[model samples]
Target chain A: MSLCVLEKVSKTYTTGDLVVYALRQVDLTIDPGEFVAVMGPSGSGKTTLMNILGCLDVPSSGRYALAGKDVTAMDDDELSRMRSEHIGFIFQSFHLLPYATALENVLLPTLYLERPVDGGKSRALELLSLVGLEDRAHFRPNQLSGGQQQRVAIARALMNDPELVLADEPTGALDTTTAAGIMRLLSSLNERGKTIVVVTHDPEVAAYARRVIRMRDGVPTEQPSGRTPRPLTAHPPVTP
Target chain B: MRRFISSLHQALKAVRAFKLRAVFCIASVALGISAITVIVAATEGAYRRAYEMVDRFGPDAMLVLGGSAEARAIGRRDKTITVQDVEALRQAFPTAYLLVPMSSVREVNISYGNRRHQTRVTGTTEGYSRSWSWPVVDGRDLSEADVKGMRNVALIGAQVARELFANTDPIGKFFFVRNVAVRVVGVLEERGTTGAGHNLDDRIVMPITTAMKKLMNEKTYVNAVRIRFLDARNMGRYRQEVRAFLRQRHGLKPGQPDDFRLLSSEEIIRFLVALTGSLVIFIGITGVMALVVAGFVLANLFLLSVSERSGEIGIRRAVGARRRDILFQFLLEAIALTLVGGLLGFVLGVAAGPLLKLAADFPIYFSWKAFAAGLILSMLVGLIFGLQPARRAAAVHPIQAIRSG
Candidate 1:
């Protein structure tokens, strides 16, 4: 079964007498173990599409399914559960709680679980180490550099061990070298059988994916990635 | 359960992050709770004082005053009950255990070896000790010889002993009242202060014969007469009979208001409760107002933080926190703040007993019931005011995690 299936999903915003179509009957699908990039300019409805794909929001019309379960008909509570159990989201700004340490941020999802995961503490520490932030687990967001803060956020995104990872401009706040390092990490996770979807307007970021979906004026067109695919375990040129 | 604890932990961290504002919020809750505690303490003290006084006065006792209470309120002073009235009462109540007559001069300067103290000086018979339920801690009680021979001997109250003697022993000491010298033969036990702040232990008592001969000069009228009966169940019947007998003895005409008043333990309790009723009610109103004001301060405090922490709320929701979780977090914050205030107020209220005693002779006592009630009341205030802030916190859109700061 597909990891996520969106059929003619539409989202509209109504303000006073004006109606704006953020997403106009956009249909998309994400299969397991696939790396896809969604490229769109500002106001192209890419954020709204990503929100629906990640189950952070529901569509105004049409159907959305995640892991074989319908999502558009789910209430806010079920949407929260779907996001927690099946998908992980990463934002460009990191969105780390200012008062929480890196480890605490990683453990945050466990707090909302029906029964918080046993050995979750060790798993949080392991994820931090995987993101090269083991030593910074006790540090708050402000104490870390931008790259290090993003690394902490990435570790938190992986803490729940979700199969689908959704990132929205994950490297937008980082330098070119740091952005490349983050893309490499996402690439490595994709190779480990995680279905990854990255949203960005930058072609450089989109080039890392195997398939590219470009959105123009609320319309999406599919294309084969320009670069040849590397082996599943193949190492790319990476920087820390 | 873990989620609830996590929410509480988050609430504590939020409060700790901005301690100055937390203090501002807690002040109103503490003020209201402290006032509540004081009111409870005052009320407890009033009833407790009445109970103790009634016990000392005895259940089967009736006290007849020389003037009517209603008339005294309008500044009417009647010197109607005289020595002859006491003799008449003794004859009327043949089953009475004791009948004692007393006359006291308030605010008299008494001196011993240049150490001076002002106190009430009372003149009474030898049965004064038995009738008042007062016992001597030092020396001996007044004997029949003292009243019959009109000796210049006296018994000192606890407070008068403390003031005049300090570290010196009061027994065998000589104190003078208006140039009439009397040697103290005994020191009375400590009786503390009354509910109205009257120091019951601040007086000197001497034989009526000595006071009449040396100080009063005219010995015809006395201030009050006390009679103790054999059975407490018959006090109501006895009270009526005594009223009729006194009126007849005084030749009081029908419809002409009797110039004297009769009192019992029940009457004393009613008067005391009535006297402290206004004070208790005033404190109660202020206490409730304080709680209400504190609730607003707390609600406003949480509201401000909810808006300020919108980003944080969004992050939490995105990480899978349900609306109930967000609601719990804010509710926990409110309850935690008010509980701290309740604790502070309870401690201050308990300590106020000693402090107030030293400052104003305020009667107070510690009651766990009142403390528990205050705690419950404070928690209620938190729940009532916490709803709006928690709901607002939960209403924060999860999309803010990607958008807002």
Candidate 2:
């Protein structure tokens, strides 16, 4: 079964007299273990599409099934629960709490969960080690480099073991080499059967996914890669 | 429990970040609470002092003073309280233990040889000594002959004797008051202040007959009469009986109001407690208003905080925080701020009690109830004022907030 399904989804905003369509007539589905990239220029609605899929924003008019649940019918609290349970987000700016250590930020989601997740601390440490930041677990976000911060964000995204990872320009603030390193890490995560959706305007960033969906004027066109997306061969290994 | 701790942790970090603002808020609240505590302490001290006075005077002690409804209506002060009234009261309450009619001349000039001083001169019967628990320490008290013969023998207070005669023996010393020769027969024991800072030992006691017939040449008048019941248990009944008898003797018809006022030591204590009670309550209300204003300032500060941390709030929302979670987080932050402020206020208030006593001789009582009230009020004010900002913080759209940042 598809992990996410969108049927004729549309979102519109009325600013005074003019109506702006952020997303329009979108039909999409992602099966388990799929890695998809949404690419578009600024104002092309790629972020809006990612937001809808992540359950951060509901479509103005559409039917949305997230993990086979009717997401379109959910209220704010229900949407929050869906986001907490099934979706993990990686933002472009690497939004780590400035005052909190890397490890604490990773454990933040579990702290807000309805039921206590047993062994949450160990799971957070394991995710940090997965991202090769276990040694820097005690370092605050401001103390870490851009690459390390993005790595911590990646670890946090995986903290809940969500069904889908929505990364919105995850490496947008990083240098080329660091971006390549992040892509390699995401590729490994995808290889481990985590369904990952990356939203980016950069072609090089989108090249890491098996399938690319290009958005223009709130609509999408699918372009299936002929072969598996290549990970950077020059990047360091996953294990430190 | 974990969530609560996490939220508390986040709030502490926020408070630390805005250290100056937090300090100012706490200080403002502390000032208000301290004021409340000081008033409570002072009033409690006054109440205790009044109670002590009542105990000293004994429960059966009663007074009939000059200023009554009929006296005020008649607009005559000199003859309002008369010897006749005292005689009538004694006749009515024939079994009374002791009754004394007393009057005073304020700021009278009295000279002993070269040393001259101005002081209060009280005139009364010999019953004044026993009725008020004042005893002569040197020489002898006045006899019945002193009053009947209208003699000029005087009982001087310790303070008056010390000021006038210095080391010279006061007994048998002659003093000229109103240019009339008066012999000091006794020196009364020292009585301290009246607790209201009035000197109790700065007086000269003389027989009422001398004061009325010789010095001032006034007759048939006394300022007030002091009475002690023989049986203490009959005090309430005697108090009512005296009032009724006096009203009849003065020919005051029903509803015409009493020509004289009857008071007991108990009534005086109750009056004083009520007076101080209302004053303390007024001051308490003012302090509470100050606290409410502080709460408003706190709420305003938190609202500014919410606005400043909108990006962080949005981030939390995206990461799975429900609206209620955000609300709870901010509410907890407010409560934590106020409770800590309350604690600081309580400490400051407790400290101020001794300082106030040192500075102004004001008494302070620090009860657990006042401490708890100040703290609980702090929390309650925080919750009331912090609600609007917390709700605003919770209502932000994650997508819009993220984009705005």
Candidate 3:
């Protein structure tokens, strides 16, 4: 079964004397172990699509299924549980809690779990180390640089060992070198059988993904990876 | 329970974020709870003192006075409890009692040669000592012979002795009360004061016979009669019996209230307590208003901060917090804040207790109920005040929070 499947989904909004279509008819599926990129300019419904896919927002019509379970049929709490257990989201600005240390931020998802996570602190520290931030685990967000903060966010995203990790402009605030370094880290995670989805308008960011789906005015078009093949062993592996 | 702890943890974070607002919220609650605590303690203390005075007034004692309550209010003595009534009362009741017929003339000028002092002249029998459970500190009490012979011997109170004799012995001294000369054969026991702040030990006591005949020139009546029964639990029956006997002896028709009034010790305490009850009500309202005002402050601040904290709420929601979790977090913040304030208020009230007692001679009692009330009232305010803001916080959309942030 596919990791995620969206079948003929449409999301609409109504304002005073006007109607807006954020997502028209859309059908998409994501398989496990695939690095998928969702690319679109501003107002192309890419953000809305990612929100619906992340279970933060519901569709106006049609079905969204995750791991054979229907997303639209789930209640708010059920959706919360699904997000906590199976999916991890990374925001463009790296929405890390300003007051919490990097290790505490990574352990945030465990606070909402159905059962207590044993060895949660050690796991958080290990994830921080996986993102090359083991020594910065105790540092607050204000104390960490932009790239380091994003790395802390990535470690947080991987806290519960979620099956699918979604990144919305994961490198939007970073320089080219830092952005490439982040993409390489994500690509390495995809190699280890985690389903990764990267949402961005930058073509350079899309070059790291194995598959790309471009959305224009609420409609999506699929494209294969257009970059020349590169050697995988150029950098050290980030896998745990 | 797990969800509650999680919410509590997050609530602490929220409180830490807005330190000024949190402090103000807590200060208001503390003020309210402290007011309630002090009021409760004061009222409780007043009742305790009132009851103590009543107990001292008499254990199983009832006093029959000479006038109507309304007439006494304006300082008019209607001359009711007479010689006939006293005789009838002595014959009617079981005489295994301390029955004392007494009459008093307040503001009488008593002169001991060069020393002149104004004091109440009370005329009663020797059992005045036993009836009051107040033994004479020096000299001797009034005797039964003194009452029967209508002698001019008297017992001066400690204050009267101090005033009339200065450092000299008041025993064997001659004092004249309004042209009636009396020899001070015994000094009365020193009583400090009544609960009504009347000086108990500033009177000169002579025989009721001498007082009626010699000082006030009255032979037909005595103004007061005091009775002490065996058991206090049977006081209700005693009150009815006394009322019936007095009315029958006084020749009253049916449905006519007796000219003479009867009072029980318990009734006196209850009357005083009822007075304090009004005071408690008045002050209790102010305390409750303080709490309500604090609650309003807390609610207003919470509502104001919700918009600012929406982004935080959104972040939590995206991280898998349920809507109720967000709501619980905010509610817990208010409850916890006020709980702390309540405890602090209780401490403040208790701390102020001794100072109030010293300053105003107030009776301030500390009981667990006051403590519990402080806690329960504070928490209730928090819950009531926090609900709206928590709901608003819980309703924040993650997309909007991210955009706003």
Candidate 4:
């Protein structure tokens, strides 16, 4: 079964007299252990699509299934439980609690679950080490560099060993080198049999994903793939 | 329970983070509570002392005195209360076990050689001591022989002894009451001053016969007659019998008003008790108003704290704390603060009671009930005042809060 499937999903937001169509008849399927990137311009409904897939929001109409269980009609508490158990989110702004230490921040997800997974602390520490932040476990978010804070956010996202990892412009605010480092960490997590979905406007960041789906005006378009074109030997060079 | 403990600990930690503000809040509440405690304790002490003094006078004793109107209409021509009235009352009422005619001569100058002072002198029969329950501290009381013989003897109070003797023994000494010499046979024990601040132990007692025959010249009627009933439950019967006897002795018609007034010690005590109760209630209401103001101050302080710590509350809620949890946390902070303040005020009030007594020149007693009331009232105030701010804290939206941060 696919990890997440959205069929004919739509989302609309009404602010006063104007109605905004954030998503229109969106259809997608993501399988286990796959890396996909969603690229679009600002206001092209990428974040809205991400929010729907992460269960932070519901589509106005249609079916959303996670691991073959229909979740579009779930209540608020059920959705929170689903987020706690099945989904992990990383935001570009690195939303870490300012007062908590890095380790405490990572422990937050497991606290919401009804019961902690075995060896929760050790798992949290292992995830911190996975992101190369094991030495900064006791430091608060304010004391860390932006790159380190983003790495801690990534570590916190994996605290519950979630099946699907969603990154919304994970390195949008970082330097090129730090962004490359984050992309590499995400790629490594994808290699470890975790399904990864990243939404970004940066083509270079999208290059690291195995599959890239481009979005335009709240719709997705598939691109031709799978074969490398033959090199035209010398004749095509400078013909003009 | 463990969660409650941790929550309380966090509440206290939050208060401790801002020490000066917490101290200011506590001190304001303490001042109000202490004021209430002092008033309640002093009022209770005064009532207790008044009751003790009333109890010292005999339980079933009643006073029959000439009324002002009757004394005026007679114009010294008709006798109001006299030795004959006492004799008649004793004869008419077998229930009247002890009837003594007594009169007071205020501002009488007494002298013993060089020492001279003005004092009140009360003349009564030997039954006066037993009827009034006044204990003789030293020497001997007046005897029937002294009364019949009209002997020149007197019993002085504690203050008179201190003033005239200057630590010397006063028994067997001779003192002159308005130029008439009298022998001192006994000294009364020191009875504390009355609720009205009259010194009960600052007077001299003389035999009625001697006081009437020698100093006062036996020419005037007596001031009043004190009667004691055999059984206190028969007081009404005794009162009726005395009224009838006075009417017959004075030859009054059925429609004519009685010549004298009859009052019981119980009646006087009841009046005084009611007065004290009203005073206590008045003072209590004032204290409650102050407490309410303190409660408002506390509410304002907590509201300010909630506003200042909105970010912290947002963080806690985001970390899986329920709305009820947040409310309890803030309420716990308020209750803890006020409870500490209440206890401190109780301790200070108790310690200050003696000093208050010295300042007011009256006795003050510590009461646990008042302390308990202060503590409970303070906690109740905290709970009531804390509700609004706690609810506000609980209602903060986590999503909006996070976005703002």
Candidate 5:
């Protein structure tokens, strides 16, 4: 079954005297274990698409189905529940709570889930070990390096054992070496049969995905199965 | 239950993270609570002590004194109370518990060997102790023989015992009053100072006959007549009978004013009690104001905390904390702070009572109700003032807050 399906989804935001279209009649679908990357320029609606797919924002008009459940008309509480149970998110800034330790940060998502995840600490430790940060579990965000903090954020995202993971510019703020490490982590998680959607402006970062989709303005220009795209350095990028 | 405990742990952690701010907030609350409790306890203590003192003067006793504005205006200053007036009141009101004709000789100097002191002297019948509730501590009170034979004898006060005799026993000792030596037959127990700071136990009591015959000389009148009613509630009837007897004995017409003032001990107690009650009310109101100021301090502190931790709140929301959870957490923090302050304040208030007694030279009693009031009031302050800041923290938008950081 398809893990996520969007049918003619659109989103528009009105700011004072201007109306900005964040998404325009977008239709997409992903199978249960596919890895996809969305690439676009600033204000090209890639983040907006990630927000809707992550259940943080609803589409202005269209049907969004996640695992055969229509979530287009769900309220705030229901959306939160859906996010807690079915989706996980990683932000570019590695948004770990500053006051919480690494283990405490990883345990954050489980706190909101209705059902308690068994062996929560053990699972959190396993995720931290997977991200190569088991030794730094007690250190706060300020005590960790940028790369370490991002790894902790990734571990936090997977705490609920979500079916799908949404990462927005996951490696945007890291150095090239650290970025490659994060990309490797995401590729391995995707290889483990988790459906992953990553949004990035960097073609090199998007190169790690198995399937890449490009966006111009608010419209998708390349289909997922069109081709095995060349390396990021060779692609002729277009600005919206 | 685990969730509640975890939430409390998280709240305590948050408070500990900002230790100086938390301490300042709690201290402000504690100061206000302590001030309120001490004032309330002190007022209640003073009122209770004053009531006890008034009861010592005999709750059922009434005093009739010669007084009339119209008579004085007409130059009737010689309308003094006679022994006849006392006999008349006793006969007219057979229900009276006791009747005594009394007079005071203010500031009389009495001497014992080389020691001398100026003291107040009261002369009344042998029933004075029964009517006034003054019990003798040593030897006997003035007997009927002393009164009828007009013998020179005296009942000294506790302070007089300490002053004239030092550590020696005062019973059967001779003390000279205006060079006429009188034997002290009894020493009365101590009565604490009055509201006016007069030492009530620093006086001498002599028989009315001896005082009339020897000191004042050929007296046909007394300064005051004291009557004790069989029942305290019969004060009004007893007072009416005494007024009527005096009016008839003085030969006054129907429209003529009364020649004496009938004052009930109940009235004195009531006046003092009411005055004490008003003072307590005033102090209580000031205490409330101080607690309100403490509440405002707490509110301001919480507001500053909410502003400072906006980013943290957003992160928690992003991790799926509901608005109600955030609100409850902050409210719990506020309540915890105030409750701790209230507990500390109660301890300090209780400890302060004896210290205050030592400083003010008067006994200060503590009331449990006052302590309970302080605690309940502090909790109420936490609820009323803490809600606004808690709501503000809960209302933050996760997306906007995340962007702010």
Candidate 6:
């Protein structure tokens, strides 16, 4: 079964007199354990697609399903629950709460759970270690480097063990070396059987994914596979 | 439970981030709360004073003073409450234990050797101590021989003894009231001020016979009679009998106003308590007005905070915080602010007691009940006023809010 399925999704915003279409009628499917990259220039609606997939915002019109659950008609609270339970998101800015320690940010998702997650502390520590930041768990976001902060965000996203991880320009703020490291981390997470959908305008970042989708003016079209398909364990290109 | 605690933790950090503003908010709330605390303490002190007065002057004792509405209205000083009324009251209530005829002159100049002071000088019978429930702390009570012989002896109050004699034993000392040398036979125990701020200790008492025959040179009359019943339960009945008997003896007919007024210690205490109670209510209203203003300022501050932390709100929402969670975050921040203020105000209120005593010579009492009530009231103010800002924070769209920052 597909981890995420979007049928004829569309989103529109009315700014005074003109109506801006952020997403057009687009059908897409992301199967379990699939690594997909969405590549487009500015204003190409990649962020809008990531929002719809992550359940941060529902499509203006279309049926959306995540992990076999219908999310098309969900209300705000229901969407929030869906996001909490099934989706993990990494933003371009690494939106870690500045005042909170890295460990506390990783523990943020469990704060909203209906019941306590068994061994939640150990699990959060393990996730931090998975992202190679277990030693810096007590450090605040400001105390950490950009690469370290993005790693903390990745750990926080995986705290709830979501079905799919969504990244919208996750390394947009990092240097080239740091960005390459983050893409390698994403590739490693995908190798470990975690589904990932990353939105990026950088072709080199898209090279890390097995498949790529191109969007133009809110319309998305799939590119032919195997152009720059690298093995999961292959080293990312060393971009100075 | 965990979620609530986490939210509280978040609120604490937010408050810590803006320490100055948080302190300002707490101070405003503390000022409002301090006003209420001061009022509560003042009224408590007044209540204690009233209780002391009622205790000192036995609750059942009645003071038949020299003035009547008609006498005062007609500008007549005919000695309405005299020794004749005392005799009639004694005859009417033969079971009465004490019927002390009394008179007083305010601000009489008294001198002991070189020291001189102006104080109240009361003239009453040998039953003065029994009727007023005040015991002589030193020396002996006046004898019947002293009254019959109209001896020039006096009992000084604690304050009068302190001022006139200082460390010297006042018993057997001579003090001249308006140049008439009177020997101090005893010293009364220290009693604090009255509810009306009358210094209870700053006075001296002399025998009515000596006062009428020698001091004032007035005979066959007294200013008032203070009566104490053997069985206090029938005081009302005996009081009425005394009034009727006095009216008959004074040749007063039906529809004629009697030339005396009956005052009870309990009535005086009640009047004082009611007066202080009204003052407390007035002070309380002003305090509440101040709290309302503080609440508005607190709400405005929370609104500003919400706007500043919109990005944080969005991040929490994206991490799975519901609108209610966001609402609770802001609400808890407000409550936390007010609770701190309430605590500080309670401390200020309690501390104000001694300051009031020193500044105005007023007594103050602090009760934990008042402190707890003030705290609860302050928190309620936070909750009520915090609703609008919390709702505003919760209503922010996660996508847009997260993007803006």
Q: Write the per-residue lDDT of candidate 1 for residues B1-405, one digit (tens) a residue.
A: 888999999888877777876797777888888888888877788788888889988888888998876778798776679999898888878988889888888888889888888888888888888887889889999988998999999999989988888988878877898788899999888988765679899999999888877877857988898889999899999999999998998898999887899999989789778866877798789999989999999988889888888878877887788889999998888888888889887887777658866886666777886798779888888899988999999988888645875
Interface RMSD of each: 1.2, 1.4, 1.4, 4.3, 2.1, 1.3
| Residue-wise C-alpha lDDT for candidate 6, range A1-240, written one tens digit per residue | 878888888999999999899898888888888788998888989889998998899999988899999898999888888888887888888888887899988998888876678988899999999999989989999999999999998998899989899998888899999999998998899989999999999888888888788889998877633555555333222111
Error of 3 at B91 (Å): 5.2
Per-model TM-score, in order, reads 0.81, 0.76, 0.82, 0.70, 0.80, 0.80
Cα error of candidate 4 at position A71, Å = 7.4
Model 2 clashes, total count: 1
**Ranked candidates, highest TM-score first:** 3, 1, 6, 5, 2, 4
> Can you write out model 5's per-residue Cα lDDT over B99-157, one digit (the tens) per residue?
89887788888989998988888888899887878889899988999999888999999
Give the residue spans of candidate 6 off by over 4 A.
Answer: A10-25, A41-45, A216-218, A225-227, A230-240, B67-79, B88-99, B104-123, B135-207, B228-286
TM-score of 1: 0.81
Worst-scoring 10-residue span by lDDT in model 3 chain A: A231-240
Q: Model 5, stretches more than 4 Å misplaced?
A: A5-21, A24-26, A30-32, A59-76, A110-119, A213-222, A225-240, B57-96, B99-101, B106-119, B143-149, B162-175, B183-187, B190-200, B216-294, B341-364
Residue B189 accuracy (lDDT) in model 5: 83
Greater DockQ among 4 and 6 belongs to 6
Candidate 4: tens digits of C-alpha lDDT, residues B98-125:
8888877888899887998889998888
* Colliding residue pairs in candidate 3: none
Pick the DockQ winner. 1
User: Which tens-of-lDDT digit does each residue in A1-240 have in candidate 4?
Assistant: 789888888888899999888887888877888777888898888878887787766889878998777889987556667777888878777777665789977876765564646787898899899999899999988899989989998888888778888888899889999999999999899889888999999988887877666777777764421232223231112110
* lDDT (Cα, tens digit) per residue for candidate 5, span A31-144: 777778999898888888887887777999999999788999998777777888888878787888777899999998887776666799999999999999999999999999
Clashing pairs in 4: none
**Candidate 2 lDDT tens digits, A6-39:** 8889999899999999888788888888788998
Reference contacts preserved by each model: 0.64, 0.64, 0.50, 0.05, 0.23, 0.54
What TM-score does candidate 2 reach? 0.76
**Which of the two, 1 or 2, has more TM-score?**
1
TM-score of chain A of each: 0.92, 0.93, 0.93, 0.90, 0.91, 0.92
lDDT of 1 by residue, A1-240 (tens): 778888888899999999888888887877899898999889988888898898888899989999999998899899888888887878888888888899998888888876667899999999999989989989989999988888888888887888789899999999999999999999998888988999998888998998788887777877766774644343221111
